[model samples]
Structures are given as structure tokens and as C-alpha cells.
Target: MTSHHNAPAEGGTEELSRSLTNRHIQLIAIGGAIGTGLFMGSGKTISVAGPSVILVYMIIGFMLYFVMRAMGELLLSRSGYRNFADFAGDILGPWAAFFTGWTYWFCWIVTGVADVIVIASVYIKFWLPTIPLWIPALVVIALLIVLNLPSVKGFGETEFWFAMIKIVAIVALIVIGLILIFTGFTHNYANGTATASFMNLFTTGGGFFGGEFMGFVMGFQIAVFAFVGIELVGTAAAETKNPEHNLPKAVNAIPIRILLFYVGSLVILMSVVPWQNFSKDESPFVMLFSLAGLGAAAHIVNLVVLTSALSSANSGIYSTSRMVYALATDGDAPRPFAKLTGRKVPRNALFLSGVFLLSSIVLMVFGLDKSTGFSIVTTISSLCFMFVWTIILISYLVYRKRRPMDHETSKFKMPGGLFMPYLVMAFFAFLLWAFTRDPDTLAGLIATPIWFALVGIGYLVLRRNPAHQAARAAHLAKVADEQANARAWQDQQLNASR
Candidate 1:
């Protein structure tokens, strides 16, 4: 571990504090599962896929559940592993770790940038139409960094309340929507009309799969962005209290959360407002409230969404900084990022990520429309996130191949064994093809490789550095020794039991 000299009175440790409790972990997981994408992007998805976007969310959630399970099993398999990147480096190679860590870091940074843009342009302007976009954007960035700078527990708590607001808003929407449906409400639009009832889900416009084949496919382009941070629990493993207990609890409940939060919310929203009535540029939740003549409540929903975007940006800052800190520990990033403050927070890494988030302000200055800017960043984010998710599955497959005994002895085995990873990867490949079907998404798809190319070039340069080589070699050797010891211990335990 790297030590900081001239440490402050409260600063000396080079380790992250495991201060996040079960409540924090559970809420963080909930917050991760529900994102700004669900609140803001769902409008676009409904406009595109009609009623079938419900299925799109279910499919994405189902596949990602397996990914979470795979991650949980891998993290618990070895005590030395910090996050997926650590195991990726150990099982795959140093280059895998370098790519996975940096890619995951970039994933959140891009997502954070989008969140910033949304906060500034869409949500903030919903109230203060006259306010400058950059002012609120910078304020949000500073607030998140300051809150996160105190401790891991602070971030967890901030996320907890943020997640709670989202939960309350969605629950309120669902309850209110159900009431509207039961009372037989009717909405008259300039183009057409819709009735608030469950039947609308099927009889809205084109039926359940209303948009036809291509429309259904196009749904994945935006819906995928909603699930980008689902694996956040995996990243916070090191800072979690009693991860073995909390991690599986969080991962295992994902299915129920999806059914309740994503599927349930959408089902009610569509039932209340009808799929065809949703606007691509507006939030369905806000529309639902507006339809009920609850203009104040609609404004409140918009505020909740503003906070939702802030929550996503906050999570991005927290996770990206930790990833940088992890990379630095492995010598994959700048050494300074490895430094921990008195609270064990990665101050330098946090500041760097916050600085990068300012790019969203620049995008605003360039006068890019909110819809265009959001689509570009989110599409790129979804693609990069897919790359990171693929790395996790690939790492899991290699871990199984190399350590069958560990799999046999594991407590939290992935339900599908060896077949699920391949299945999920195939689904992701289908999503990539789906991305290419839309022009906006296709532009993002085409541009995403530039990021990988840059990372690859950086990795090549770092590989030639003698210091990095030695550090990486030492890290790999250490991982090997730890794995060997773990295997021996397992064997001894089995023998003793016999």
C-alpha cells in the first residue's frame, strides 16, 4: 500500500473504511437500479416502442441480474479481491484489469456528463427557465463532491435519501395511476384521445408490441442506458460492511426490484396515460401527473427527477473516483490517485472526476439541444457499459475454467452455471445490432471505438514503462500466491471435515 507523507492529523490510513451498513448498501443498490434514465429517458422509450418497452426493460433487467450474480460469486470467491477489475486482472491478465478498470471509469464519467447536461438543460430549466445552465450544473457538481468527500458512509447516506425520493415519486405515481385507472379517467389530446384503464396497455394504438419489429429493437437503444449503473454494488464491495451478507442480499433481490420499480411503474404509467400519448421530449411521470390536473404535483415530480439526475451524477463521481483509486493501487493510473484522505476518501480522484464533469457545461455553451446532447452521451455510455459488463462475464467464465473447485465450494453460485454468461453476451450483441439500427445511436456506436483505441494506446505506452511492468508483475504474483493459499485452505477444511 502506498503511504502519504506529511499526513494531516486525521489522515494516515491507506485503506478504505468499511463503514457502509446494510441499510446503506440496500439503498445504494436500489438507487443504482433506478436511474435518471428511467425517469427522463423512459418518455423517449415509450414514444418509440409504445407498450412493448415494458418488455424491453424486463429483458434488460433479466440479463443484468445474471451479470450481478456472476459478479457476486466472483467477489466472494476470494477475500483479496476488491472489485471486478481486481479479479479481471488476476484471472484474465494485467491488461484486462487495466482495460476493465479504465473502461468502467470512463463509463461513469460519460454517464455523469449526461446527467450534468440533463440537470442543467432539462430538469433545472423546468423551474428556472431564465437561469443560466452552467450555474446549476457547476453547483450540482460541487455539492456532490463535497458530500462524498466526508466518508463512504456519507455517500451512502446521500444516495439513500436520493434513492428514497425516487422510490417515493415512483410509488406515488403508481398509486396515483392505479387510482386514475380504477376511476375510469379520460384524457383528450390534440391529435387523439386516451382512457385511463388497464385495457389501454393492449388497445392504446398498435397493441402491446405497437411499434412493430424495428420499433421494438429501437427501444433497447435508450432503455439500455437506464440499466447502466446496475453493477454499482459490485464496485462498492470493498467499502461495504459484511459484504458477504449484504452483497448477495442486494444482488438476489434485483429481480423483485425490477418487477416492482421498472415493470410496475411502466405498467401503471401506460395504463394511466396510454402509450401513444407519451411525448419523447417529456417525462411520462410528469405527463401522468399533468393528466390528472395535478400541475403542482407534476412540478414536484420534475423536482424529483432533477434530484434523480443529481443522484446519478453523484453516483458517477463516487464510483469513478473509487475506480481510479483502485487502478492507481494497481499502478494502472496516476500514483497520486491512490492517496486517501483522513476519511479514506479518494480526494484527488474525486476532484479529477468533478473537473471532467465540467465538460458538460462546455457542451451547454456550444448550444447543443438537450435531446441531442443527452442521446449522444447516453448512447456512448450504454455502449461502454456493455463493454465493462462483458468483461465481468468473461472474467467469470475464465474464473470458472481455472478454478472449478472454487465454483463447487462457493455459496453464491450463479444460477445458470456456465451457460448464462454466453447467453447474456449474446443478448448484448443483439443490443449492439439494435443500436446500429437508429441513426443517433449508430453515431454513438461508431464513435465509441475511439475511446477504446485511446485506452489501448495508453495501455501500450504504460506496458513499456519498467516501473509499471514491475508493479503489474508484483501485483499478479501476489494474486497468484493468494489464490494458491485460498485453495490450500479450502482443501484443508474439506479434509478436516471428512
Candidate 2:
């Protein structure tokens, strides 16, 4: 891969600086891959599909890896393209960019609100059970805002360590569970007793598919949430030091990360404790450690999961701010959001996101049950995230068709060529159908179109503004110039070859 950095700023004034290095980019990618959904939602998935949840996670990860590859190629296709929104606006027109930009902003905001709620009601309650929920909720959002406000480097560093804690926790669980399996450990459950052995995978409980086809199908509904933020590396493209090198390195490792972190961890967990014994309402991570007789297991796992939530909220705040900044600079959002602090941080956008996150406390004030509220928000988030993923694939398809020369010359090309995107899109369509089969997710599915309707309305209105029209025309003109120049260069090379 080529080493492409953002062009240096003329006056070194309000532009986003490329302060994130390879390590920062790598860890941030990891943080995005491993969300609270894996930590907190795994038990539900295990309960739903039994041993088949492993396959469910594998399928989701496998599909998403292609999506990420498509996004990586598009981001690197042109130095002028900052993120997907840039290409979406350039290729799909300004409306696509505006729609995607705002939708992505909303996706993270909803996710952040959910994370804030979980931290306050569930994680904090594990320790300070008597504390008012709103206090912790507000504090979590405030802390994440403060963490991101210092500088982009500070945001990267915070996510780096937060991701490290999650990695260490999962690795520890895998290592300790392996030791138990080798030693033939056994644990008692309400359903039945299970011995710690590889045979537990098939010999105990309902085996794979949880003994029902529908259960396996249901597994996909919950498992999809665990992979929500996998494309966050694409959003960080503009701020990365070397997009061509670091982007590929980070994207290529996704399969290994899924194997070790998601599939591997689930395999080890079930081996130690039979799948039937796992509670949908509780964490399998804590149960395994507690059964293994770690006196502090619950507390330790609680801390890890808490930090996982914090890391997600931190990402939401960081990404949402940048997305707004992108939208504003493109004339798709209010101009104030484009302003940067002396540290080059999007201060106005950051505060606006935090303010939206505060609505989590407002939701709590209505006496919503933690589980129900979190489920609704997360379901909507998963649906919206799928929309974003679908756009990335569509953008890739358009890129390949319209810019075949760029595709041919790309050092990092998407695997599966023209066919894979269509296949992935079909898979996503099936996933949407899968969501409709469940009542909770079905509610989210029905509600999601309303967001699009509003976005469409907003775009229609925004297009009337002369400033928005000028910005759109200028962006398209620039892309046309770049493509024309490329075609001319190709013609010159052909003539010289003769």
C-alpha cells in the first residue's frame, strides 16, 4: 500500500491535524470492533442459539469484513475524499452525502445514549446500588466529553487503553477457561450439571442450533448488534497519519480479531459452562469466572464491561463530532459546527453530541426499564448502522463502475471484485428480513423509515438554500476535473506505448 498523508495546512489553522499514529489507529479500530454489545449481549445470543451463536458471529464478521474492504478502497481511491460522505456527495450527489452524514451522526448519538444508560443503571449499580441513576448517567457523558475535548491525540490515547482493557479481559477469560477445560472442571447449573470439556459443545445441552432452526435465526438478530462500529476506521481516515498503510493493516486484521476475540471467546466460554446454563439476562463472562472460583470475578468483569461501554460512548462522541464537522464544511450542516478549537478539536460539534447524549438521563426520568429502553435504542442503532454499511457498499459499486481506472490502479482493492458487493447487499437485505421476525427488532424496523423520511424532507428544504447549492456544484466540479485529468493521463500513456 502507498503512504498517503493529508496535505499540510497552509496556515496551520483550523483543519483537523493527522495526529493519530499507527498504534492509535490500530487500537481505535480494535475498540470499534469490540463494543459493549459483545460483552453485554453475548449471553443473550448464547441463550438464543446455543452453540450456533459462534457461527452467527462468524457470518456477521465475515460479511462486514468485505464492507470494510470496500470502504477502505473508496477512501484511498482519491486524496480529496476525506471520508465516505465525500465520495457519497461526489458520486451519489449532495443529498447522499447529507443523508449519510446526518444518519451516521444519529447512529452514534443513539448508541452513545444507550451506552450512557447502561453505565449508569447497570454497571454503576453493581457497585453503588443506591446512587441516583441520573447522576451516573450525566457523569458518564460529561467524562467522555472531557476526555475528547483535550485534543485528537488524547481521544486516540483514551480509546487505546480502553480497548486494551477489553482485550486483556477477553484474553484472560479465554486463557483461564482453557486451563479449566484441560483440568476437566465441572459446574452445577439449574438445568443440569456440565463437565468442562470440548465434548460439552455437542454432548451437553441442545448442541448446535440450540436444537431448533428458528433459534439459530434469532441468534442473528442479537449478534448483529455486537458488530455495530466496525467501520469506524473509515471515519478516522482524514486524521490518520498514513491512510494507505494503516488503513489496510487495520482492515486486514479484522478476520483474525473476530476469530480470536468473538468466536474464540465464545468457544472457550461454552466449553467451561454448557450453553444451556447461560442466562440471557446475565453475562456469561461473569458466570464463567465466578464458577471458576475467582472471588473477584464479578467485580472484575463488571469493570471491564463498564470500560467497554465507556469506550463506545467515547467513540460516539469523537466520531459524531467529526461527522458534523464534515457535514458543516460541506454545507450540509449549520456553519457553527465547522469551527475548531485552538487544539483543532471540533468543540461545537462535540458539545452538541454531548447535549444529545444527555437525553439518556431524560429517558431515564420517564421510568423506563433499563433493559427495555436499551434494547429499543440498540435495535434502532443496529438498523441505522446497517444503512450506513449498505451505503458504503453501494458507494463502492458506483466507484467501480464510474472509476474503473481508479479501481485498476488502487494498491488496496476490495476482494471479490464486482460480485461481492451485490452478494453482501443481498445478505444485508436478508438481515433486514430477519430483524422483522422479532417483535422488538421489528418495532425498530418499522420506526427506522421515519428517520429517513425526516432526512429526505430536510434535504429537500436544504437544497433550496443558495449556499448549499453552490457548495454542491463546486464539489461536483472538482471531482469532474480530477476524473478528466486521469482520463487524459491514461490516453497519453497509451499513445506513448505505440
Candidate 3:
């Protein structure tokens, strides 16, 4: 394959087809933002934060929008900002790139593992309800890897449908929820005031701040999950037909999606059934569907959850490969990952990433009995994604400072840039605190450093390799020599003119 680095000015990707359309982009945003997290765990979020989860969703949605806006501005400001890892390195530094790139790659690989576990555990019921979880987990890992190898658009198309399945399910659920909410169709056995009304959002979530400030703070847990892939739209910046136009359109659509899907759905759920009673044993969507007495509703919602996990893993792989591709191009990762197929897909990097994704299965094999291990992996994925998110915000800070003129002209400038960045930073730090406080999420926080330690060790080992060391030295020396020559040429030209 010809080097994308030197390819004609038009298209840059080699392995991926430009088969994605506006509908695809819209659904990608829709599919990504709403996932298993919202359908399955949102009930838990509402239970914890009460109706204030609405505010939680709103607040997190608002802040994450800035992150996307920052990503959009940086990408549009320069063609070089193809992916987040590349943008981090260009604006922040090589270390920033190395950290962001590898960490993000690890983020998905870890997340894919979690998805595998969920699939094997939940979907096994369809065929052999008695089968051990590990058996199905292995099958899923192999199946996903095979599917991913077909090429990016194939992956995109599959994900499009996977996402479509999820989107359709949620949209249907929302419609049904709205109907029950208006018609008082839900059983009101205990709660006398379960009739059609709007105050249910406030009343059902265990009366606002269920406990106190702590209860409100706990809401972030569920809020964070709902917003997990909120930045997913930005990951497709380079591949989209017209990024600047589509990216902002994608970003701006978040509010409506959050409103109808998250805020709207939650309103109906809590309104019908008090949020306090929901749990992992029961999903609010499933509960509502069953309440409607819909035939095979549990099975239907299970399929939705299954689709959600698969979509999450699918997005994870795409993002992981891109991170590897970006790092390879920048010389942070091995050059082979930089290889792209004629269709503009990073096949080599993708293949290499597939190899790493097996860690999830391996994790499932040994950790099946240990819920602790599962929790740790979950937290680590969250922490790693959080780290990646923070770097994006920081990269924007550096980008704006480094190029005020370019930013001024940027069509997608981040609003309230300086102040908002600080506020978001503080909010993130508070999230870190929340992680420490929550048992379910704490394992992940503890697990992340150990994961990073291995990455750091790998980086050091790679940096020490003789061939790579020489390449680094040569690249640095070439850059220095070029700078020196430019300085000398400037002086000579000035003297000659004088």
C-alpha cells in the first residue's frame, strides 16, 4: 500500500472505505452515546441520585460537549489533527501523544474484554442456559476478531446495524414510556400517585438527593456511564465526508439525544416505578417493557443489551486501531502499525490490536469466579477513558495558547474556553474522588496504575531497542539540523539584504 503520509492530497485513509454517510454519522453519534450503560445501569443511576440524575445527565452532557467542541476545533484548525492521539502529540508534546495514544488503545482493549464477558454471560441463555460463562466468552472473542478483520466499512456497516438495533430499541422504549406516562397504564399497586404526571422525575428518584450531598455525588457514577462514549463522534473526524460540518452537527445533536433518550426515558421509568427499587437484577427498560405486558419483552431488552455491548466493543476496536495508526505514524509505535491498506484502513495496526484484545478473554477465563477481578477491569476501563478524556481537554488548552490566530479563525471554537476548561478540570477531579468513594468503581481506579505501569515499562523497552533508538536519534538530529539551517539561512538573507 502507498504511504498515506505521502499520498495525494485528497484522501488519506487506505484500508477504510468512505462508505459512511450523514445518516451513518448521525447514528454513529446516536449509537455511541446511548449504549448498554444507559439501558441497563441508568436505573441504578436514578436510584442513587434520585431524579437529580436528570441534572447529572444534563451537567455531564454539557461538559463533555465542550470536550467534543475542543476536539472539533483542533481537528478543523489543522489537517494534522486526524485523531486524538495525533492532536495530543502535535499540541502538547511527544510524551502527551505517547500517553494518550497507548492509553486510549488500552482503554478499548480493556473495554472489549468487559463486553465479551457481558455477552457470554447474558446471551448464553438463548442457546444453552446452563453453559458456563467462559465457553461463550471465547466464542465471542473469536467471532468479533473475525468480523473486525473483514475491513473497516464492514465493521462500520455491522456497527451501523448493531447501533441501529440499539437505537430502534431505545426509541421504541421511549415512545412506550411516553405513552404509559400519559395514560397511567403502569400498575400503581403501592404508590397511590402513580397516575399520569410530570413531577415523577422529581418524586420518583427517591426524593431528589436521596440521602444528602453524598447521594447527589453518587449520581455521577451512573451519569459518567451514560456519557461514556459521548466523545465517540469526534473519533470519526478524519473519516467523515466533511468533518467540520458533520462534527459540529454531531456535537450539537447531543442535547436532543440526551433529552429524548436519557432525560425523557428516565422520566417515564421513575414515574411508573419508584427508582429506588431498581437493580442489576432488573433493568428499567426490561421492567417497563414487561410492565406493558409486551410478549417476550425480557428477551427483547436482552437483545438490546447484547447489541449495546457488541456496538461498544466494535467502536472500541475502531478507536483502538486508529490510536495505533496515529501513534505508528508519529513514530511512537512501531512503523508497521503505520501501514494502511489501499482502502485507507490500518490493517496491520488493526491486526496487532486484535491480538491484544484477547486479554479480555484471558481475563474472563481467570476472573470468572472473582467478581473483584471484573470490577477492577471495569474501573480500569473507566479510568483509562477518563485519562484519555482529560488529555483531550488539556490538548485544547495547549492548542489555543499555541495558536491564537488559528483558533480565532476556527469555525468550531470551544466556548468559554479558558474558564470552562478549568471548571471541567475541577469536575473531573471530583469524579476521581467519587471513584475512590464508590466500591463498584473503586477497583477500576486501583487497577489503572498497574495497567499504566506495564505500558510505561513497554514504552521504556521499546525506546531502548537499538534500531528504534537510532531512529529516534536520527529524527531528532534531523529536526535540529533543519532548525539550525533555517536560522543560518535567515541570518544570511538579512545580511545580504543589508
Candidate 4:
């Protein structure tokens, strides 16, 4: 294990600046975890799982909490580690880093492309019904690129406010829902009149699990998508101020966020409107607001969902660029991606990610229904994230065995130690089984291995190049020296503190 005192010095000349404050880190963490999945997809999930969707979220959240904890401890263990890939390389070997890094990059690219398409389509409906969808899609890609070009701080500020809107909306929903539930507000739906009450959740059509266990199993696919970006804070550790303090604070807040934002809001939505009343064709949020007699609720929710898409797209850009930059620095990607701008932003990397985001325009040109396109892309993204999470857990197990001394002495160690990683792995295996149950997710699961094969082929080709071999050797040497220095410094700090 490398000492935390040894900051990375090999690529010190072109590193991202630590301008993101504690507040920026907090909201960015929140922003990354919450996406269109909760706002838009929840309607379909509720329609399928009924009130049992609450249990689905809680179970997923409970398992992922350990994943986040494992990630937190890994990042804080070494100051030089930029993201999961860096630690994966150091602990697991170069191959782990290569695959994990590229896979994560691929995940965000697909997610970003899907998000911009959604954003553009929403804009066409709400503000520019007359315009072609491609125009707005191009404009959105351009706008986000400009927003990210300035610096890391600019990205942080944009995400902070974008996340605030989501937070405010959920809080408002929960508060208003409590009032409605207590007052026994009754709203007539197409099927029947639903009186707002706690019992409404279980009384509608059927009781918990909707009297069909398959419905509960089906919700697992979309529910997993809702928690896709929970590990994003681990990626931001290198660019955060006082990460040892801020990182844990952000991670510890995950349970509360899930409880309040996910479970709490779903309970409110179902209680206010019976689960059977939610339409798979529309957002449950819009339905709840409209049921409360808000005339423009559709438009309002449209705007909110639009911003949520943009926030997620923005995050995709930020995380992918950083990952690419890290890969380049390690000689695993094109050298240009490692070059930093005067403001210390990875401009080239950001531009490269933007180029892929333009592919969303191609989806529009094909005339696929926007909803269908989004569903396919999101399924692929969710499956890819599962791979990334699996790698993180695998790396954690290795870290414990290889660095027992560090694990015993570390301040931010994962609570469950050896047992937790295996438990989390088992849960992920169940998710894979759940994926096989649905044809859509099953297609994604089958298609995912082709991506790994492509990456493996690329790795083999890169390994044969003399220049690549030389670069890898030099990079490894530099990292080795840096780790040694870090360990020495950490020993001094320990002695002094004693």
C-alpha cells in the first residue's frame, strides 16, 4: 500500500487543480447519483412493481452503500490515485486499470449521448415545438461543451445549481405529499377515485408486491439504473479539497439521500396516487402535481426533467474526460488527452468526449422513438456500470489481503472488512440474474461482452508496440518512486504525531 503522504509527483506538471470546495463536492456527489431514472423511469417502475418498488429501492441502496464505502476507503488510502483505475493499476495490476478505465469511459459516452438526445427532444416539445429535434440536440451539446471549457470550478458550479433544483423539487414533493396524505385529498383518475392515505399504497388493485412476485423482480432492472453514479465521488477525490474529510462526509450522506430522495419520495408518490393509477406512458411526478390541481404541471415537470438530463450529461462529460486524462497519463490512451489547458482543465479530453456526444444526433436522424432509444442506451449504460462496480469490489478484496497493516491502521477503513465485499458481489450476481429475466436487459447483458472483447483486442495490439512498452515501463518507474517517497513521508508524519 502507498502512503497517503506521498502526493503524485510524476504528472505534477499537468494535473487538474483542486478548486472544488466542500460544497461543490457535496452537491456534485448528489447530482451524480440522481438522474432521469428517478424522475422519468419511476413511473414505469411504479406501474410494474406497485408499492413494492419502495422495497426494491431500499434493498439496492443497502447493498450499494458498502460499494461506496469500499470506494471511499480505497481513494483515501492514496493521495496519488486519481480514480478507481489508478488504484486498480497499483493494486490489481495494469490490466485491471486498462479495462476498468476504458469500460468506464465507454459507459459515460453512451450515457451522455442518450441524455443529450432526451434533452433536445424535451426542448422541442416544451419550447420549440416547431424546430427539428436535431437542431436542439446539437445546440445542447455545444452549450455543455462551452460550460465545461472554462475550468473544473465552472463544471462544479454548474452541477451544484443543477443538483439544487432536483433537491428542492423532491423536498417540495415530500412536504406537499405529507399534507395531502393527512388531509385525505381525493383525486379522480381514469380508472377510479383515489383518496390520499397511507393505506392507498397497499389497497390499490393488490397488496404489497402487487400479488405478483415477478413484478417485484422486474423493478430491479430500473432500480439499479437509479443508483448508477453513486461512486462518482470516488472519481473526484483527486480534485477535491480536504478529501479525507469531505469524501467520507459525502459518502456517509448516501443513506440519508436514498432514504429521503428515493424511498421517501416514492412512498409519497404512491400514497398520493395509487400505484395502479400511475401510467407507464407518463411521469409520476407530473401526475402527482396535476392531481393537486396545478394546471401547468406537465410543462413544469418537463422543464425539471430537461434540466435533470442536462445535469447528467454534464456529469458524463466531466467524469469521462478525467478518466481519459488519467489513462493518457498512464500511457494507455492517446498522449494529447493528457495535456492540460492554462486553466488546468483537460480541454482536449473534454473535446474528445464532446465529439462522441454528437453521435446522439445520429439517433435522431434514424427516427427511432425518443423513449425507445433512451431505454436501449440506458440499459447498456446500467450494465456497464455494474461491471465497473464489480471491479471496484474485486479490487477492495485484494487491497485487504495485500495491505493488512494499512487496513488495520487506516482511519476510514470499510466497516465490514472482508465479509462485505463478498456480500456485495453476491448481490451483484443476483442483479445479473434479474437482467436475464427481462428481454431488454437481457439483450444489454448479451451485448456487453462484445465490448470487453474489443477492449481486450486493443490491449493486445498496444502491448506489441515498442513505443507503448517503453512508455509503460517509464510510467511504472515514476509511480514506484512516488510511492516510495509517499511512504517515507507518511512514516515521518506518524513518528511526529506520536
lDDT per residue as tens, model 3, 1-498: 012322332224443345556776788898777868788778667666777777788888777877777777877877645677666765665567678888888878877777877787666556578887767776776676677666666766777898788868878887887787778664654445355456655565357666357767887864675566667766676677777677788878888888878787877777767666666557888888887889899889888888888888878878787778767665567777777767677777777766776665666567562555666666677777788889989988976665666676788788889888788888889889988877867866766788778877777877766644554555456446545665676687689999
Each model's lDDT comes to: 0.86, 0.86, 0.72, 0.83
* TM-score, candidate number 1: 0.93
How does candidate 4 score on lDDT?
0.83
In the order shown, the candidates' Cα RMSDs to the true structure are 3.3, 3.0, 4.9, 4.0
- Which tens-of-lDDT digit does each residue in 121-205 have in candidate 1? 8778878999999999999899988999999989998999999999999888888998899988887886677778888889868
The window of 10 residues in a row where model 3 has the poorest summed lDDT is 1-10
Each prediction's TM-score versus the true structure: 0.93, 0.95, 0.87, 0.92
Cα displacement (angstroms), candidate 4, residue 109, comes to 0.6
User: Tens-digit lDDT track for model 2 on 321-356?
Assistant: 999988877667887887788888888899999999
Positional deviation of 380 in candidate 3, in angstroms?
1.4
In angstroms, what RMSD does candidate 2 have relative to the true structure? 3.0
Candidate 1: count of backbone clashes, pairs at least 3 residues apart or interchain: 0
lDDT of 1: 0.86
How many residue pairs in model 3 have overlapping backbones?
12
